[model samples]
Target: MKILSITTATNHLSVALNDDDQVISEKNEQDQRNHSEHLDPMIQDILTENRLSLQDIDRFAVAIGPGSYTGLRIGITTVKMFASILEKEVVGISTLKSLAKGIDQKDSLIIAMLDARNDNYFAGGYFGQALTNVIPDGHYHIDQLLEEIKKFSQENNIDQVVFVGSGIDKHDELVQKLGLNYTYGSESQNELHAGLIGKLAVNEEAIDPDKLLPRYLRRTQAEVDWHKRTGKPFAPDSDYVEEV
Candidate 1:
């Protein structure tokens, strides 16, 4: 089976092609806020270099966010269209889960985080050989996340905690204050990799094209502002209008 995967869930944009056993080609670049321009062409380049077409791909995979809202949209929308037109299987991988898979520390508490601004982070906790989630994925304040990690570690008797993802650098001091046996993820671990995403999705079930959507853990700032103005929940179907 052949799989094509795309990841725009972080500051990086990555495209990968995987044959039955391994990644054949991958294109990754740090293109913060320009997924629209880079993603499609990178996809085309990978396919072209490999001498394969969309018809040759047996499945499609994408990182379905808790990261950049716009980046997630760009990546998932592209997959939806391609899969729909080609009638191929499509699976969505959680960005946090993919980050966890990239961590090399075995049996250590893996805390994957993405910057959500204002001292809050999109974080999840995973551990052990299976990379099971100890803390469910969601948006959280730095202190709140640490508290849960501390509690979970003591309960599970996991001694080490490893922080991974692009957001880790911003919260170095806060992570350090936890005073556990801990380490920062490497640069490559901090960036998203479409190859890892494809591998993760290989055995997963595929959802219908129209049914797939980005997993934005919190409402957009515009969505929140709309509620403040009218005291009514923002309807997602309506066009978004940002208040000045």
Candidate 2:
């Protein structure tokens, strides 16, 4: 099965083409440009160089959210559009999971974090050979996350752990201060290769493209700002708003 994957979920916009579990072609950009323009053409180029087309693809994959809103929207929309026309299956991979995949170790408790501003992060803990199950999802401050980490390790007796992601440096001081058992992802979490995205989605089905949606783990910035100014987010057009 050939799978195409995109990682517009972070600063690094990466794409990859995989044929039967092996990487055939890939592209990655850490630029600030909007993904709307870059994503499609990159896919086209990769396909062209490989002498392939949309018809040759068996599945589509994307890095779902807890990341840049624009990136996530662009990635989800683009993949969904192609999947719809081509009638292909799509899989949504987590940004954290993709980070965890980059690591080559297993004994360490994998702590994957993405900076979410305001001392909060999109973070999760995974501990296993393949990161089977280490923790739940949470929007957490660095302190709160560390607290949970300490508690879980005490109970499970897991001491070897590594933290991966671009957000790690944001809390570098704390991580160093605690002398926690950790190491950053290779390439500094800069290369979010789409190969990993496809790697994680191999078993999933290429379902109704319409069923695909971004895993928006939090509200958009505009929504959050509006809530702060008006004491509520965008109100739905309910009966309360429609009354004459």
Ten-residue region with minimum lDDT total, candidate 1: 235-244
Worst 10 residues of 2 by lDDT: 235-244
Estimate TM-scores for all models: 0.92, 0.87
Q: What clash pairs does model 2 have?
A: 89-206, 109-161
Which tens-of-lDDT digit does each residue in 143-177 have in candidate 1? 88899999998898877999997566677787778
lDDT of 2 by residue, 74-186 (tens): 99888898888888888888778878877777777888778877777777888776676576655677898888787787788877668787666767778776545767776
Which TM-score value belongs to model 2?
0.87
lDDT values for all models = 0.86, 0.77
Q: Pick the candidate with the highest lDDT.
A: 1
How accurate locally is residue 82 in candidate 1, as Cα lDDT from 0 to 100? 95
Off by over 4 Å in 2: 177-179, 188-190, 224-244
On TM-score, the leading prediction is 1
